[model samples]
Target: MELKKRIEKFKTREFETNKEFYLGIEKGQNPHTLFIGCSDSRVNAEILFQARAGELFQIRNVANIVPRDDDPDNNLSVVSALEYAVKVLKVKNIIVCGHSNCGGCAAIRKLNDYKDDLPNTAEWISQSSRISDYIDGKYPDMNEDNKLVLLEKLNAVRQLDNLLTYDFIRQAFDSRKLNLQAYYYDIGTGDISIYDYENEFSDLIKEIALS
Candidate 1:
């Protein structure tokens, strides 16, 4: 069967299983968390968190990156979403989540020749250029596995910094109205490591959980 026909069949049957939950959500959505995840199909926030629809306001992008706004116009979508989530939606926390074995991370290192065909996607993900600089001479001879780990961790920190650049986000954080977090999901190990900005990407998941 065609993909659209398969999708239509699922849409027809989905209502019976999920309509009640979705109906109540239409009344209003008051999600407490804004989950920033990757565009990777493998990373499903709902399933990973065991959350229902409307429980998370999700923003997805290449390498799960959120751009810093030297000018908000430079990143209108990222800035606008942060404005709504922090000022209007009042989400308590924002999560910048990255995962292992990410194609976006790999694509950054190998500036493949798809530039002719997929020029826009190539340019869009170039926001991740920092990853290349960070891993430059440091991993010149490192294996692919090690390179990906470095990419995953660096991307998370880069995005965390980007998340902080917005005034609304900074104000919310300073006023204690919001919290930000970064995590790397390891596909091979099914383990998640939280990156600490303070101790230089130190693991503080345990200490933070105490709060």
Candidate 2:
């Protein structure tokens, strides 16, 4: 297709224009922080964090899941990356960031809609069914924006709990060698909110803020 061909040509041109910029990344990257976030194009952690190349080691997944340890095939890649970042790279911080209006989070709301066709996704999203219920009851009378905000907060906590199932994460936490943080990005306002582990379902809109 002409559109696909144009994209390839644009990529080549971009590389030629930014050759040195990309080449600096050739030797290696030693990011201080590990960012685990969504695969959503709009929720780019680099852009949100104002992180330049080599400043962030980013791990992205559907629904921003850091699955339990028992899931070898799924958890292996994340675990490997985590181990490399923590043990080898010795990164000081790891952040799990979810976002508002997530299709994955919204899927829990319409589980029955995909009940017959999307078996795997249904099961996968069921991890946050409690999130669905929480959002459901919290914002039943609120607007769509409010409902999405509620889901965003709940998703962060749920994913953080999922991360705790990993031995490496718990070890890191227990040893106080690393700080694990949960966050949510509001695409509508281009704002980030960090999770306060103490205050359930509350976003640290001010204290954990970044420009």
Candidate 3:
């Protein structure tokens, strides 16, 4: 089917089925959480969270990176959305979610493979190379598959850390007005690993809460 047909189908089918939901959306959006995630087609933040309309303010990017607030030359969209969500929307929770089989993380593992041809993508993903450093320093013996998994989890943590670089976020966190979390999602098995900044990744609790 064509894009317009798909949209019309949604308007008549899904939207018609959820008339009240769209009515509330039409009134205004007052999302309670900010979901920062990768732009991968398979990772739909709203679907994964089973979120209703206006429940989540979402920002999706190449690698789900949170560039440092001081990095004025990069990630203006993310920064703007974040400011609006936190400052204007007053979202109480912020989650940085990374996924398995992420092409962006894979590019980091094989940086040389894409650096020459896909320079822009390489530059964007390279911002999260701290995950590579963690892999090197902490899990040097891990196999390629395990390494990618570790990278996926670590990238979420790194982005969470980056979130604190913003003074507003730091203030919100410090005052206990907002919560920050990191999550690693397995696309194949639908498993989600939560990251606790206080402990090593292995020590954190892993859950299989698909519903």
Candidate 4:
């Protein structure tokens, strides 16, 4: 019911029934995947993937954005986490997942509308400040709703592109030790579309099957 109650329940369950799993995680986390997802409350990466503890190294940020390596001030925490996950943790795969009706993406569509109170948030999503210009020029005939949907998907691809900027990630990828994926989740329909950097989005499929 209440947040505290839920936490207490988890504590009891952890020591009572899930003790072994918790104990194993306490020893060390050896997550096989790195999940970069949105800060949206409804988008829980572990729940969506049905992942257990220590299975994923997760980072949540506005719209699942991955700041370019050249931009140090944009998202330093993300960069640090990524470096740890790749260079130290040696996570084999990384996923940048975006979701439908994302408030961050919506804010991108209307950056100028924010008040002074949201200065930090506005600055954080500066990567999408000029998104309107792109959408207008690229899809002049597309409506607002469709444009936002396209923007969300494009942002996912953009994050994957950003991941390539990191030297460790690039080296791992080149050596076939690491893989990257872009995913778009439709909150309304509960469908997730995976994007290949080269082609369009499609239903979930094995990475090796993509061409």
Best by lDDT: 3
Q: Ten consecutive residues with minimal summed lDDT in candidate 2?
A: 202-211
Compute the lDDT of residue 97 as modeled in candidate 4: 91
Distance from true position, residue 156, model 2, in Å? 1.2
Decreasing lDDT order of the candidates: 3, 4, 1, 2
**Residue 193 CA error for candidate 1 (Å)?**
1.6
Candidate 4 residue-wise lDDT at 196? 69
On TM-score, who's better, 1 or 3? 3
Worst 10 residues of 1 by lDDT: 202-211
Clashes of each: 0, 0, 0, 0
lDDT of each: 0.76, 0.73, 0.83, 0.81
How well is each residue in 1-211 modelled by candidate 3, as lDDT tens digits?
A: 9999999999999999999879878967898899999999999888888987789999998879989877766578889999999999999899899999998998998887898999989888888776676577666787889988877887887777678889999999889899888888999999988775556452321111110
Q: What TM-score does prediction 3 earn?
A: 0.90
Error of 2 at 77 (Å): 3.6
**lDDT winner between candidates 2 and 3:** 3
On the 0 to 100 scale, the lDDT of residue 57 in model 1 is 90
Q: What is the lDDT of candidate 3?
A: 0.83
Off by over 4 Å in 2: 1-21, 70-74, 134-147, 198-211
TM-score on alpha carbons, each prediction: 0.82, 0.75, 0.90, 0.90
Q: What digit string (tens of lDDT, one per residue) describes model 2 on residues 1-211?
A: 6999888986799767888988988898788898988778888877878877788887886677766666544657777887788778878788888887888777777788877898887777766666666556645787766776666676776666666667777788779887778888878888788874446543432222211
Indicate whether candidate 2 or candidate 4 has the larger lDDT: 4
